[model samples]
Target: MAQVQVQEDPDREERITMEAIVDAYGSEEQAMGWYYYLDDKITFPFQAKCIQARKVSPLKLGEVVEVTAMAPADDCEREMFVLIRWVDRELAVPLVQLEGIDVDDETEEAIADWHYWMARGYELG
Candidate 1:
């Protein structure tokens, strides 16, 4: 029998993360009000209002989840929200819970900088 080897790209996870960010924020230019996930939580520069999903299920501690921003329906109260999706479950969280990263420079720069470190497997300490 012959053996076949499969190797995964080192930057695959980072690329996926960046893609999700782009999808949620609709381009780096419009990402000023967007947030990034770090340390198992979303953070922002200033204090702001946020909403949490009505239902929360038990989740693994270090699982990687994809997040997306969703616009509220016509009848909804808030203007925007986020959807956190994982293996087999999804949760809705208010935009306030997410903290904006780039308050000074343009969001594009922030995204590029973030992707640079993340692609190299950098983690916050």
Candidate 2:
């Protein structure tokens, strides 16, 4: 069976740990419940905590962020949309077209590809 590995964020200097979980997946106090860590543990309108990426170091750095969520389709990739969220340093930095999805190598790769394509002078032949 494939095992899910958890790692730390690296964007910041200090070590930041985030236990990623989906609120709707299981009940609270289940040790694995998404809401257990998210529900009231930290206040909303906070900084973004985790980012979706592929094959990244477990100790990556990210801020604790809160965003408004919207229901997603069954076949759709993301489960929620980040309407408004704050960063530790940046206040109310607008994240347009932001959708929440499971973090993995593919997600990271896709994000990198998009960034690569968006950069100047980078194009497919």
Winner by lDDT: 1
Per-residue lDDT of candidate 2, residues 1-125 (tens digit): 12323232243112111333323343222222322332223233322344433232121235334454321222112211223433343222212222224434443333332232223222111
Quote the lDDT for 105 in model 2: 43
TM-score of each: 0.26, 0.24
1-125 per-residue lDDT for model 1 (tens digits) = 11322333456445535643444434332232233332113322322222222233233433333454342332113222446564676565434233343333343343334434433543322
Q: Output the worst ten-in-a-row residue range by lDDT, candidate 1.
A: 45-54
- Per-prediction CA RMSD (Å): 16.2, 14.9
Error of 1 at 83 (Å): 1.3
Name model 1 segments beyond 4 Å from true.
1-65, 71-76, 100-125
- Please give the lDDT score at residue 120 for candidate 2: 26
